[model samples]
Target: MPLGSVRYERVIAASADDVWALIGRPERLHDWFPGITACSVEGNRREITLQSGLSLPEEITVLDDRLRRFQYRIDSPFFPYHRGTIDVIALSDTSCAVMYATDCDPRTMALVIGAAAAAGLDRLTEIFPTPIFPTPE
Candidate 1:
């Protein structure tokens, strides 16, 4: 099956380190993601429960602290796409760009995955604290 990809980017008023810190902590996902009610990580795998009482399982595929990038694969029966990546890049002292990308078989559930990503990003922006850093002179 051919893979289809979807991507979303947003500029957040937060440092890369700070954003990474927030993203890296699995247990804190609900704080930034609206639909997610809880998250738990066991070893390299994570389980996320949605507000709708649905639960999804994912495995950490890539975790590069130096580069501030992380990737995971969704193993839930609810999602067609089996994998996705979340990346955070420092744009400035007080700004960072977050990008989420997912590749899945278009024939299966591309639309669902895309819509969920968009909603998740929106919720993340709304719930997370604004980035803080020293003023650039």
Candidate 2:
């Protein structure tokens, strides 16, 4: 089956620079991403411990501070083809938007990942509240 993709976005009250500083760091993923109880990174490899105590391995494929974006791939036999990317776009000096995207084989995987992404964004809003007005076009 062809790969399926999902994208989720949330507006944050914090500045893009602030959000980037935190989210851009792969080691700090557990802070915002839901269900990630712990995270450890060595070089480009990362291991995340979920709430269920299951450890999932992932590889950091891209970390672009210039663009405030990062991409990672899950390493698991269960899902041979999986890739996730996160981008923080600056809507203003004190406001920004985060876009989380995932691509994986089997459409069902996209639904699961999309839920996780939505949950993560919901958690992030606690730190960065939703914008009152739409971000500038």
* Count of clashing residue pairs in every prediction: 2, 0
What is candidate 2's lDDT per residue for 53-75, written digit by digit as tens?
A: 88989999999999999999989
Worst 10 residues of 2 by lDDT: 128-137
State the local distance difference test value for candidate 1: 0.74
* All-Cα superposition RMSD per candidate: 4.9, 2.6
lDDT of each: 0.74, 0.87
Best by TM-score: 2
Candidate 1, residues 41-100, lDDT tens digits: the string is 888898999888988888888888988888888886655656777889999887788887
Stretches > 4 Å off in candidate 1:
77-81, 106-108, 128-137
Give TM per candidate. 0.79, 0.91
